[model samples]
Target: MQLDTIKSPGGSGSEELVPSRYAVRVGDIEVLVVSDGVLPLPTQMLGHNADPAVRSAWLKEMFLPQKAFDWALNAVLVRSGDKTILIDAGLGSDPDLHLPRAGQLINRLQATGIDLTSVTDVVLTHMHMDHVGGLLVEGVKDRLRPDLQIHVAAAEVKFWEAPDFSHTAMPPGFPDALRAAAKQFTKVYHNHLRQFDEEHEVAPGVVVRRTGGHTPGHSVVRVASGGEALTFAGDAVFAVGFEQPDWYNGFEHDPEEAARVRIRLLRELAGTGEMLVATHLPFPSVGHVAVDGDHFRWVPVFWDY
Candidate 1:
């Protein structure tokens, strides 16, 4: 069935029965997790370093397909004090990639009553096309505020200048597409780029910190307010990461370092019991980490209606 063409009972035009956005209140700060649709990727992207048989076993354990599966793409919208901050822009339109199901962030944001111009600041976890492409969408730049500041790690900006894909194991065409998208994004938004060394606060209680794992400038954003907190881990952790913390994801530039970073972040989250949300996790991926023997576990929070 053509799900996208399905209309609501009231005939309110094409609308998805499945939710695309979920809201969670971190004390006084308001955070919304928006889905950018899903990307169908090969299962090997889960962990290229893992034994093929072992990886297949894990997929079977999770009741997932062994060949390919849909990976969730999520972005966050944070309202703290007077600022409306976007944590990551979702995958924008990439006809070359033929990922038609993804890149729904713009339309979904509008459906949520969020105006592009209202965003005061943007905090990028990294310059991956999926994380920065939404801003590069046609006419997206024109709608955004001229003075909008995009916060990113300085190291990330430098790394992209001569990005090395020696360590990555992505599907064909991904590397080239990523390079082109990053270059175009940098050229178009260079003036608004706000490079930070280690960490920077984009708004009250919203801080983005460099972790340097999946990418040289890879980072995570932590939102804390009124004694509650949540971390938006962009590409650091994945669905299979908990069970196989050391497994090398196909997108990591430095697989070993990425594994180290993942373990460290997981340990921290498990210890603190803070909410965790990751870029490629399931939609509205709000959850907590738990120590599971030698590795870790994902304990998704119970939905609140």
Candidate 2:
């Protein structure tokens, strides 16, 4: 399938489904954007401290839809030589999410002619439900590729595995199902899991950096090959958070620390012109971050087949 073509439920020209796959070549590495699906988020979920009036006005000025915001659930597939690395498993095959249209990562991969059995490594940016939920399918773990090496931060494993894990610090309206899903993840993948700290290289060209805030072990994956580079920027920043580095995400466990890490890393990435693939940007979430005075903005790469 071409990168620009969207294959969904109803054939072509149907609005029910958006393009779920995009491909870009960064030097010697091939990056594929695999989308599970889009989720409808309430605009009120944005955690900016602006007054109601100011927030409403800002949304109007941006010409955003009055109701809900659309957040794309994206996963990055990095093919470097012989290694096939998947960053952030999407909403898996479970139909329980009942989300309008989600849990399509494995199907989308098959549609794109990518073999699931060939995926050698699975690196999770954090333990968010959307990122780690796909680790298991229908309550069964490692079903996709049992031998796959699953990598995550040591702190994240510790947080999720604690017997008395608490959600007190999580944002309002956070779903308890996520905690259950994470517990299952820890139980099933414990044997295949590899925990790493900062600057640990997982693949030939991929390195993990500690950029916590969203979660204790939240981190970003940096891929460099043939003098070109890109980053899988986990959940460090989202749509408006790009422009307002101080804005906290409702899902953040440590809002203060999340802001600190987001601002600090964004400044460096923006200054360096490093390409980044956001987990929750629009489809084909790859983009470049530009420093806009005291804040930053996302400049999406032009679409190409």
What tens digits encode model 1's per-residue C-alpha lDDT throughout 73-131?
99999989889899999999989999999999998887666788889999999999999
Tally clashing residue pairs in candidate 1: 0
What is the Cα-based TM-score of model 2? Answer: 0.88
lDDT of 2 by residue, 166-257 (tens): 42233334456667778878888788898987658877888888777888899899888888888888888777777667766667777788
The reply for model 1, stretches above 4 Å from the true place, is 1-12
Superposition-based RMSD of candidate 2 using all C-alpha atoms, in angstroms: 3.4
Candidate 1 TM-score to native: 0.96
- All models, RMSD in angstroms: 4.1, 3.4
**Index of the highest-lDDT prediction:** 1
lDDT of 2 at 40: 71
Q: Residue 228 lDDT in model 1?
A: 95
Model 2, stretches more than 4 Å misplaced? Answer: 1-17, 93-97, 139-143, 162-173
What do the candidate models score in CA lDDT, each in turn? 0.92, 0.75
CA lDDT of 168 in candidate 2?
27
TM of each candidate vs. truth = 0.96, 0.88
